[model samples]
Target: MVAVVVELLALQVPENGYGSINDAKVLAFGEMGFGIFGSFLVLTLFFKPLVCQQPNTDESFVFEFLQKMGLNPPKDYGFSGSFCSWRGVFCDDKGENVVGLEASGLGLSGVIPDTTIGKLIKLETLDLSSNRITALPSDFWSLGSIKKLNLSHNQITGSLSSNIGNFGRLESLDLSFNNFSGSIPEAVSSLSSLQALNLSHNGFESAIPTGIAQCRSLVAVDLSENSLNGSLPNGFGAALSQLKFLSLAGNEILGRASDFTGMKSIIYLNISGNQFKGSVVEVFEGPLEVIDLSRNQFQGHIAQVNFSSTFKWSNLLYLDLCENELSGEFFTDLIHAQNLKHLNLAYNRFTKQRFLQVDMLTNLEYLNLSGTNLIGEIPSNVSSLVSLRTLDLSENHLSNRIPPVLAKNLKVLDLSCNNLTGDIPLMLIGELHGMESFNFSYNNLSFCASQFSRETLEAAFIGSVNSCPIAANPDFFKRRAPKHRGLEIALVLTISMVCLLVGLLFLAFRCRRETRMWVVKQNSFREEQTISGPFSFQTDSTTWVADVKQATSVPVVIFEKPLLNFTFADLLSATSHFDRGTLLAEGRFGPVYGGLLPGGIHVAVKVLVHGSTMTDQEAARELEYLGRIKHPNLVPLTGYCLAGEQRIAIYDYMENGNLQNLLYDLPLGVQTTEDWSNDTWEDENNGIQNEATLVSWVRGLVRRNQALLAIDPKIRGTGPDAQMIEALKIGYLCTAETPSKRPSMQQVVGLLKDLEQITL
Candidate 1:
């Protein structure tokens, strides 16, 4: 029977097929092969379980994807069993397909390769955020099943593609803190299911797409810190009824506070740092928990609004209306906002009033009413708010002694620039060590320095009278004794004049070396230096500098007028020894004082604050740069004096006063007398024009391709016309309606550098 089967197999094969078999077994090979195949087929059918296992398509695709991404799969993802067991990998109930990947903050880099991640057709949630990914693969947009996509905090660039519309099921999309530019694609509105969309901290420009109003399902939308402009789209607030948290801050969106009336569910609304103006009452119509309308032009009083009908005041946890044009009495109804933790109403033109009736807001932790024209005594009722941690009542006309019963939990206290008088409370003095910031400067308050450390005294009282009784201040007798002792003062004055003449003669030759050496030492010192007193030979006048920091043995180094030699003694006498009466302004860096030198030269001395991290070399370099540069509009850096840790820069005093006074000191709609008397204030040569008009003029010229016409005639032929036009275009960009739309100073420099022959 075998021989018969072999003859049949041989007959089925080609004639040449037998040559490839062993020559010795050529005749019987067909019979043996037929028997072996039949036996093996029968065995495999019965024992299939003994065969080796291989992964399914989903597992193989996941392995390949991870391999291509150069990612090390979690430890549990061994070369056996299912990938569903791996960390950050989610699978369906069947464990057959990948459904989600929470691979955020992984060391993922470069482009997401094509056909790798997209191959996971069942993927729903993918979080690749906080990576170094620069671009997406071509097939990435094909992940139609994705419900949540988070690629935030990455290096992703370029416009978000219209192809993103393919994510029909996406519920949350976070691409914030990326370099994505260009207008937000209108196709983003196609994601009908998207509930949370965050595209903040990007370079996105142009008005927000009107189609975004269609995303009625959006619950939270944060488009802050982008170049978005124009008005809110029609039906934006009304259509997105489900929206609760919306932060369009740091943009230039123009609209009234009333525009948000339809967002009935808005619990957290922050439209700060925008160009939004007009009355602010309607913004409280929603049951809001947090409301930040700061840095806008919102005006009008809140007294007329019925807080009871507007919303649940108890639900309001945070409220910031700072830097607006709002006026009238403080919101007495705010007492009803018992849950409010923070309240900032600073820098507004409110009418003079008594201390805030905030004793009811016991939960208030932060309160700032600075620069609000507040008057009367700070009510002791404030002490009832035991949770209050920070309180700023500076730049107001408040009078009388600080309440002894201020909140014990208060960590920050600023009562500067007030008429507060009387002795400092022992309670506050005892709590000095625990306070983070305590300023009572420019006040009539007196405090005993016996218990307080020199650091505490200097830090707390810069411009205080400090006229404690002899029992409180041991030096009180010594300071007052100078007035009665005429002969002692005369001898001191004589010696000071002689020493001043000698020091003047000495500094005239080596002033440069002395200035540089003193500056270096001032910058190098790590410890705080306080100006305890002036030179022994100098006058006894107590100036603002006396309370500042310890004095150093260095002369005032005049940069522009090197020959105008003056010792540190001269600076003391020039500004009445840094008297608080001569105090001009409390600047961000420090304080500025107006003084007159011996040569009838009026100068403004700015004192750089202590505890700066800036290196000595950097400080020196900055000073040198400022001294070398001269601009017609800028105050010339006349000189500088280093007194230990304190760095003082002197500039030619402007009789016209600082910018704050020029802009805000007068009443609204009132022009400066100079504006009427001097037509030169409006002269185009001085680059003075209505800011809006100038922007419009330049924009028109640029739009018509005649930007060169707006350029200064002197610099017209200096640089290439193309470069000039490009530079003008950048200037136009800087004057954008919103700060977010404006290029950063760094970006502007980079753009200018890209242009040939363009000078900044």
Candidate 2:
């Protein structure tokens, strides 16, 4: 019988580690007592039920509970076998009485009806947490045998009932993360056997009930993130000597540190985000593993505080004292805490020390000392801490170069807003690729162009200088100021004025030459027109126009000039009866021809040929959708026409021709000299190749770490060098030799946007 009862308890207990070890031990002892009594009751009742084959009273109660709560019973064992066969249901040794039911996270909803679960007099453990249950029946408080009740993470509302004190044998009660409001009932002091109470993340307000001190068996209490105000109850901590975990964080509580002195067994204490003010030294007297006193008004000197715990090896693992008024030598008192893994002392006013002695705490994993006003070089021995992963020393006055060797296990390092100078080490640059975060911005440090690429350097270090001038030029410090300073300044000014005058004259001369060339070309075109005779179109008969109108009756739809009312006849007349002389260009989608309408509005007409797959109606609909698209960079589709097999689209003519012609067709006698587009290299087979495409040439330069050479001469002095380098990197990725490796157009646009942000 004992074995069967133990198995039932094991199955019902949550697998998730919910409470501290001390809470578990106390709850375990109480549940064991319930199991023994249940076994005895079954043995005494078994002898009286052998002769009769009557229905079980416990099974009937469980069935009523499932039905009223809209919970489904198992298909195979639906009222046919013992209720123990159902999932999350447990029965006593005789299988005649239901004792445990775990229906957590089942998405159960609606209010439970009265007289359903209340009839299970033998039920000891009931867990219906993580559901949508809104309310409980009035009779639920009558379950005297329930040792543990968990209804957390639900939408249950209304103030807790005073009748909750009827659970005299309840050992653990968790109603946290619900919408329960109003002052906690004073009748909760009646649960003398209760060990753990979690009422956090709710709307419970007002001062804590002083009557809670009567429950000396309390082990863990989490009342954080609520609006509970006022000071702690008298002797609140002195009475709960067995408490292991106590958290009142994110509340409006105000109390001295001495109120919590008697918690000898406390392991984790978090009272941060409150108005508590006092010396924190008294709160450090426990076998603590975690202590968070941050965001409070505590003031103390670190040398006077005791860093030792009750354990021999120092069980303290995390300590946060940031944003307080604490002062003194920060690390001197922390040497005894060898097991400390996380320490945050930022935003304090510690005395400025020339050298920090934190190398002794080699087990540290996370450390933050920003805004503490420390002024000195970071000690080189900090690299010895092999377990260090995150370190923050920003907003300080520390000067000198960074230590060459940092712990390779570092994943986050922030040293921004400091006076650190000199070139960043190449080793640090190599390690940046794997780090999650690294910031050296707002410092005097410089990065080498040869070692750092814009792709590898994250934006966290954006404000650092891009070029390492001292390293590139060995004689940078050797140059001295001239003794004749005034004479040197006068000489430089005169030379600059002369250069400026000469440049203006050269620009004017080139402008004059280009104008003369345009006039000569215009005269030659006129001479050619005269030799070919006057151009004229034959309009001998209007029968051809009538035939065109008969072939296609639909009028041309114009977007800009809607009143033009052009037809297929008017288009044919403007294009000189579709003569080849009016042809402007030929493409895959038929030919484009230039035309002048009757009102002297110049337009370009494109003939679309989609074959027989697209009907004329479908083609007209598609053209209508295309005509609505309007962008400043795109030519507007002015009108469209459908004439039997051909689909005509008319657009506003551009005086500058197509993009390819405007870009490549330079004026005559102009030479491409020093522009970024003039990229040429000598190949072994071909002496000097200027015909190499821009993408291929830039790719070679990027591979050799000379991406800066591809920057346009005109833009080099106009924008930041880092933005140019990043732009080149994007170009290199877009022009990868492997077609599949190249980035899509969408990704390319995103990269360009990032470059623009850098420029800003």
Please report the candidate that would top TM-score against the real structure.
Answer: 1
lDDT of 1 by residue, 705-733 (tens): 56788988988887577777776777766
Candidate 1: C-alpha lDDT: 0.74
Candidate 1: clashing residue pairs, number: 9
- Candidate 2's TM-score: 0.54
Question: What is the per-residue lDDT of model 2 for residues 1-760, given as tens digits with 9 covering 90 to 100?
Answer: 4775545534434332111121222234465687676664464344222212233366556565665566554232343333467677888898877799887877678897777678788899999999889999988988999999999999999898989899999999999999998888888889999999999999998888887888899999999888889988899889899999999988889898888989889998999888888788878777888999988888878766764455433677899989888887674656767888998988876888655566677889998888788798988888888999999998788999998988778999989777899977778877877888888876778876444455344335545676756656555456557788788889999999999999999988855553332110111121111111111111122332334445334567787666787778678877876665776654446556789977898999876645335765456546756776767899888888876556789989887677544443443336665343445455656532664666666765655457788887888868788788777776666554434334557556655766676753
Q: Model 1: clashing residue pairs?
A: 530-549, 530-550, 531-549, 531-550, 543-577, 543-578, 543-579, 544-578, 544-579
Compute each candidate's TM-score over C-alphas. Answer: 0.60, 0.54
lDDT (CA) for every model shown?
A: 0.74, 0.72
Question: Which window of ten consecutive residues has the lowest lDDT sum in model 1?
Answer: 528-537
